[model samples]
Target chain A: MKNALLSIEDTVALIASRAILFVSGPEHLLRSLPRGNWIGGTTSYFMTPEGGASREDRLFCTTFDDAVDARMAILPPNGLSGLIEHRFAHGFTCIVTPAFSTTLQRYAVDGPALPGLYNQPVFGWVAGVHLDRVGQDVPMVFDGATGAASADGLAALWVALPETAEVDLDIVNLFAPGDGESITFPEGGFDVTNCLIGGVPTNLAHYIVARGVDTTLPLVADYAGAMVNVSFQTVDAENGRVRFYAPVVPGTIYRLARTVADYGAAYAEGAREGSAADMLSCNCILNYRYAELEGRPTGGFVGPVTFGEFAYILLNQTLSRLSVRHALAA
Target chain B: MPDGGLLPSVDDQLWARLLTGELDPDIKTLATRLIITRLRIEVAKDSTVLPTAVQELRRFFVENKFAHRDLAAITGF
Candidate 1:
């Protein structure tokens, strides 16, 4: 695999070479690319070798050189399950859903119920606009097969791998459930007005304010042995409501994450365990902002700083990496 | 041992229990929900994921050690 930030001319040439690619760049640059075996999402922030930087002219591209066959598609509205049917039996799938779209919300809430979701290695991110232009600019994903861009469609690339190739996908999360109340919601959703705090009904927004809880820290839950996070988006104390980047599922016990004193050190420690080469990875935009990653290196981890990371399911405030390797012959 | 073969009878019992939310009381947990959902499709049809489903369930059952006698008899985990 080859991962790098390239000029529009170089990216165009790479696409013309018919290379299977996962591209991330500014919306205009992504829209300029020619049709080929590639899929793209809008994002200007990237973790480059030099350091984290937001560039509009260059595109971050990861080419899957070992993939023998590839198919790219844009899923229709409320059609996330279409990805399951499009999976390659022996390979992995990369998906890019536009941020704040109905498809993204649906996937956040209903993705766990999607059949065959765990049968294959599925990973990707929610495309996002620059932080400076949050509401003024919209996130978009591209189906490179048709040179088409959609603001709300879920774009996916399904690649068929050779027998010798193996793909593994996982996440690097720095947060763990803090020693606090066992929080649970009555229903699963992105917005919440009421929740059970240690089995006592409490207003979520009021609880956050009353306890002086740091909104930057996400609510963490143990999914099997994995620590999943639902990052806080906004707190409307007057209305007794709160919003989260990912949905909080019903019956899932949660606690606010333990504080990390140093973000750079934690990520660096996590990066040391990752296989930097031959890996297609992405970090959360929240991490980029909270850690002040601009011009700072995350050890060897590099890719787009996405709005949200996908490892089987949508994740928040985490790093998702997918590595493809070729097995040695006996 | 083929990838797409019909799941063995023992696994079918586990799959049935999973469908009925008997595999784990906390069925709403992300992992349990995913495991059950996957089995729902792979069990209903012969697919390459059946073997994977069986292995994952065995691993989960072994780790959690669900106290269901029927599950223990079916999986021996």
Candidate 2:
């Protein structure tokens, strides 16, 4: 039998359980959790092994804005160092949960209205497990940026052991354009890439070229229109334990399109426009990046289903666009 | 200043006065706004029932005035 460590499933389950507890309980549930901007737009709960009753031990519950502000407020004159020191002494653990709202739709050339679908509010939740023992006062550097403030933000769990932990990171670019095609730019003040994606006829070739750079290219900006997808991942290896974290569920696919006539229109109206590309919505997975960079490890990895869906959508869109462009140019 | 005893109607202001010492100016402002908003909502629900509640609340505030008036001056409102 294969040796089983902490599977992504186990981590997600823990996060989900904590999230449920937070949402179902008192309003003050968010006040006590580890505070930060990444935890924004989400509810959070923090508990320790020795904490008292749920009500008494529960730390805090608040909106993302409040959470960020609170976290910012606690920073000391030397930045994150003070906060890290406090965390070392407290034996802290935290859970962050996010609530997303929007609909994803896919378009087909044959139909006036393309086949559409909606994804319900998917919550991104993660648990924090502290591996370090309390009382060893270690000198740690504190970078002020909200995401880079702590080790947990950069990777999963900071184990303060007798010896320092060594970790390796792999950053894989998942999108790129196909071979032999080139997109040249018309020199001037114009942002060629943005122009092509945003609706400038002269910039079409540039968009194609930009897509060529990434093996995981997005759908052709002209054919598919504009899309936004969030992508991020972090792997933390420490003390014989490897923790995988996906800020957003990689398998959860969300199709999104521009709802407004133009970029300005969309911004003014505060919504989307055009047709959806699977996985076009902001990938919650990036939250893991924010957490990891901040030295906080949001416990749990993105489930396989979500990861598969994200990868498929990313690959399909890029390859499909390249194929179409190749045929059109030919 | 009696511990845990119900103060007379005239002494209701003592609660606010006392609370002022324990809370900072910003906290005082937030607490006041919270209390006022709650009172306003209650008053809106039943205007007739609010006068008593408002009087009691005001009295509590007056009696419990902070040691430093600077703390009471901070108004989130």
Candidate 3:
């Protein structure tokens, strides 16, 4: 089971391989990959604090080309333009290098390329997940308004996936039957537990207790009814620690009843019971939101990973427990 | 009061002085040199002129202490 989860690492490796695969088609010749051009195809950059001369600190970029290619290779039914527009409105900037071909020019942003555009850090976890599921590239754009002064913002890069590729939800149960039996709240009605997920330290639990109108006492809520879905995101910061979290329904009954161990078990169980075709996009804000709920320090940037790497991580980590309704045809 | 208030019509007088090469030659030379240097640096940077250029301009202002209107007119800011 552990080995299976490491398959996400394989997905990361595969995507890295694809990023270096710079074969030019018959129509165009390959040119030198220039400095200052944003290099990560579907990835964005972020910053981290540092000491000494590195005081003007910045985040590092990781390659995830394999999943990006898989998603872009398979065009989504509605196309990627709408997704691109959606991300732009959310304050992401997209840059396309000449290697992707200048003929695909109609979608380019108008006005001269803004100076110091790439100097800021990008938050792109959601888009990276989407590209991993789909196989084709979506247009990326940056928003100039919000966080432009501080150089802290989010960007989404989309790529279309093959119509044939399957996206499904997989769940597995990692806890024993009595592992998460009872959860007690501190004076505040919710207890926050700090734990590590995907190599990141995160606050895993926080919920509001709901009191029924009739009873003066607060009652434990059932979170399952309130939550449509759960998302987990892990980001590596330059500070040698990764930040991560899982978000569920808020202001609902489930907040009082569930434990972090219970949630993990549910996640594993979901993999065991659900189909394999649904795609997941882990929100980058999940960790910060968790920290906010727990009154913990939440400061750090989420670095960019290609779509392929995200998918690889998702699929490998949850595959066996994943309810495999359909299989990729050999 | 004299015609057109107590102040002289300095614009015409300054123009005449410049035409006659009677204005301070050192100030003219410094202004011309600064303008040419700024233009060349602007072209080379291929972006906004660096902070150093702005600092240099401020240093010139401190040394000469020109009137606000004159400085504004000279820089065309």
Candidate 4:
């Protein structure tokens, strides 16, 4: 089976029992398991059918039928971005870790680029929950060795599937245009380091104040015909900068739209297009808390509630998922 | 200076010494800072008990010696 949301018992049982395995859940429980055929990050949220919104410390797992050989690597903070494209240049990869993680903190600003992963279906999430890991668990990707999640490290799980299996990456965005106003950075980029708009490199907080844009609402852009978006993280009034969970691509034109849509319909259709066969999926914490998805499901997609997501880039306020299906007829 | 075990009470000694009758502006400021630092330490220990801490401060004020009027105007003293 490509994917299944196994119970706590079944997950622990299935780990070493399977030929190849990858898992996600809380740090303490994941660390408790014996070292075997699995790797996971710390998180308690998942997407299930009752509109899939819940903090379940259970595992969403993947098990390949045939004995699969995998190459694993630890991408340190400095080199993670460059390393991904090179390592998984040809194979399928499953990356898991928490956000503001030292390994990921650089990318929070660097706008990490993987040389040739545009077509490679690289999927993962920035995993962690409200700082129970503060004094206890270290928010991290662990492999059972008294690991520290924050300061210590992060992990990338790479698995090469069978020839028949092809990967498809999907994003479930539930926002339609509301109060549309086309926006852009006319001259340069707006990042944590230099927030600019209309060619003036000022802090994002300044620009937002100057423009009176609601920082809570996301900005969407038309990449060809597809509407891609960037979500806000913190409005650093002190720093005069606004940090986003994802990067605002340097030269793209964006529009400040009041997002208005239904989550249930968005995830259901997106997941179905991938044949409703997701091995890994994560909804953003923004969508979870702000969208009030605590007990409700998002149609039929389910996984962890992540701090951020990577559908080849850092994403916010979106559910990004992956599946391995047979190549559709050409 | 104390010969016995009774160290002079910080509150009692301070009020007895200066800034009493019509409270000078400078000494009042120093007194305000002294009370604030001690209150801040207790609050910082755990902010969850903030309301209870405030009540405790009010109780201490009620039990203590002569001082400024308008306890309602006092934000945290």
Write down the TM-score of every candidate: 0.84, 0.20, 0.24, 0.68
**Per-model CA lDDT versus the true structure:** 0.80, 0.23, 0.24, 0.57
lDDT tens digits, residue span B1-77, model 4: 11212322334423322222122223222123233323343344556645554443343344322223323234224
Candidate 3 chain A TM-score vs. reference chain A? 0.27
Please state the Cα-based DockQ of model 3 relative to the true two-chain complex: 0.00
Candidate 1: misplaced stretches above 4 Å? Answer: A260-274, B1-77
lDDT tens readout by residue for model 2, A43-161: 12221122111232222222221111112212322232232332321111112211110011111111111111000011212222111311232112112113332212211111111
lDDT of 1: 0.80
Better of 1 and 3 by TM-score: 1
TM-score of chain A of each: 0.96, 0.22, 0.27, 0.81
Q: What is the lDDT of residue A39 in candidate 2?
A: 33
DockQ of each: 0.11, 0.01, 0.00, 0.01
The DockQ leader among the candidates is: 1
Q: For candidate 3, what is the total of clashing residue pairs?
A: 58
| Of candidates 2 and 1, the better by TM-score | 1
Per residue, candidate 3 scores C-alpha lDDT tens digits across A241-273 of: 211121221222121122234432343344334
| Cα error of candidate 3 at position A198, Å | 36
Candidate 1 vs 2: which has more DockQ: 1
Ranking by TM-score: 1, 4, 3, 2
In the range A1-330, model 1's lDDT, one tens digit per residue, is: 789899999999999999999999999898889899999999989988777899988899999999989999999767888898987768889999999998898887777667657667788999999999999999999999998889989999999999787666667787899999899998779999999999999999999999999988899987644678999999999999999999987767799999567666765665454456447889999888877779987767789999999888899998888877778856
